[model samples]
Target: MNLMFVHDVRSETYNEETFARSYGYKIWEERYLPVFNKINVCFRNKDTNVDLNGISDKSSGPKVFFDKRIGMFKGPDVFFSRRIKNILRENIRNNDAVIVRLDSFLGLQTISECRKINKPYMIELVGCAWDSFWNHGFLGKILAPYLFLKTKIEVKRAPFVVYVTREFLQKRYPTKGISTNISNVKISKQKESDLNGRIEKISRLGNKIILGTAANVDVKYKGQKFVIEALGRLKKQGYTQFEYQILGPGDQRYLLDMARKFGVENQIKLLGSYPHEKVFEWMRNELDVYIQPSLQEGLPRAVIEAMSLGVPCIGSDVAGIPELLDKKWVFSRKKDKANEISKLLKKISKEELKVQAIRNFKTAEEYDYNFLLDKRFKILEKYKDFIRREK
Candidate 1:
């Protein structure tokens, strides 16, 4: 059976094989390929530059439908054109089952088309479009309302709904369907066991904690500024043993400028983007405290990765963050994140950190790929009849 995956995640090339080698391998291996014999991914044309340093050049992966005209905002010309809609309709008609990654402009259109044709499709609620309103630019602010409403309707109409954050997305977009909470983080049992040893090592390390987070610095909603300010507050209060290390691809000028403004420039280091293996290595060996103070989130994978490495985490009390962290480890994103975080930094002891790290390691084990793959396999078992139906 062929699976139709509708999303706007663009890759560099249009060649099916090259595209899969670069971007589609993981989804194919972990999510779609296990269930479907073949997958037909409908995605937008290449638009932005992505880091290609670590992507493997392998031949095994998914079928691609690189829609040249479909994208986030294709201007007035593409919006009124029937060709994009026709292309989506054609793609949807050829597949046995549909999986729409919601909140994308093209994906919503495909889901709407699926509804019109009465094709059974599952909705993967990964991120919320409505929560991103304040972060958008002038034109994006204008388009956000339409996208939010479109996503809301599409989710409810979907026969199956899987959310990265169970409580967060469910509350915002309620659906009466076969629903399940499935996170995308995929650690292994061996790695979890290794992390227990790492926690023991961390407990032996001295003071001068390294607080770190991984996120694109360009996005304002990530609350990078808040983390910096919290560090500044900690420094001002005579606590000078910690440093903030951020990893990810983005312009660091804003964060640098904020660090300078707060007079905590020396305490912050922007490590930039690293490969997944390197990131895990760094988290395990280098980082002492993991921080996820995002103003909003859909269950951050970075925080979970840090936890899996036996690093104690402090995250903002929003979305799925609270679900992963204990109440004491959680700080308010709006009200007193800086104060709460600074307070926690001062009060948290080494023994407490070790205990919390072990607790977190246990929590992160549930999201391991081995477990999630089985969970997903069982979930898809009920939909086998729908997935295997002929066109």
Candidate 2:
């Protein structure tokens, strides 16, 4: 078998690469390559191009191509281009199976071409892009119809669809057949010896580390502002020992200014962005509690990683988060900052926190790479037969 995984979206590669580090991408590339014999990944370098310098090991088994000039034409006009259609038609001709990661108009376009060419193709839905745009007030009300029409057409035409969450399926296409989110790899348990140095570094800072949230500050929907406000309230109530760390890239000057306005500047630390591995290390040893205040998400890897490390998480009650927690562990008043922060503080305890952390680690076992990969391969096997019958 020959498999080609097409990623039209560029931004996800950065975080995906970091998350896959615990489970080597080369190992994953090898597993899929031999199962199919030949595997190719077609993607576009929209922003910063991916450096293929160290990817040479798996480069031969699974060829990766980054087209620099693709997606030059923005908006709906992109779908009508002959150049994109021709390029996709050529790629689909040689590969026995193609997996299209949802992020670009090309994924839907390729699905249409695959249907015409009698090629086996699968659609992977990370989330509804339109929903994200709408939630942020980025997409105008005038464009709602256009977005809805496009989504409906794509869902109806695609042979198979993979959703990251049940919420995604219910909101986007209720009747569509759904496959659970599949992780290409997994993270191994970090040994205590490996974290000793980091633990010492954090211990040097003092004993009172309270809460931490890691994400790009510029993304308003991530809800760092809400956490900041919550922390300010906690400080006003005489919770002086706690420190809140916001880690990621983007302008933190305004956030810092906001902290000053709230008189909690001393308690808030804007760590900016660090290397992914370093951040993961910090999450394991430096942080006391992990919180993801995002207003929306599609099975965020940060929360999953924290859970895997036995870090108890307090996330906004939205999307797939409750599913991840199995409705057992969650911040009840997540929409109300002050109440949520109060609840979090009340829940923290030496013995109770440790017990909850163990539960968090145990919950993450179901999402392990081996388990998800097995589920995915089984789906693909059945899907292959389904497509054959259709042919």
Scored by lDDT, the top model is 1
Cα lDDT tens digits, model 1, 1-391, are: 7777776654444233334222436757667677778876776555435435354222234453444445444532334558888888887888787788766777677776877888888887877887665456676678778777877877876778888886988988888878888887757663656566766777677767888888777777788788788778888888888889988766899999999988899999998767565777888878888888886678888888888777899998878898898788988867876788888888768788888888888888777777777877776765666555623
Q: What is the TM-score of each candidate against the true structure?
A: 0.86, 0.75
For each of the candidates, give the backbone clash count.
0, 0
Candidate 2 local lDDT, 1-391, one digit each (tens):
5666665543213322321122234543634543455665555433325542232111222343433345445545557888877877877887778888664566767777887867867777665555444555445345545665676667656667776665644466543453555643255654444334333433354558658888777767777777777767777787667788888767887788778877888888888666555667778776777888776666777887877777777887766777666344465534675567566765566655566566777777777666666676777776677666866
Task: Mark the 10 consecutive residues where model 2 has the least summed lDDT.
Answer: 14-23
Task: List the pairs of residues colliding in candidate 1.
Answer: none
Model 1 spans > 4 angstroms off: 14-24, 45-51, 55-83, 135-146, 190-193, 387-391
TM-score winner among the candidates? Answer: 1
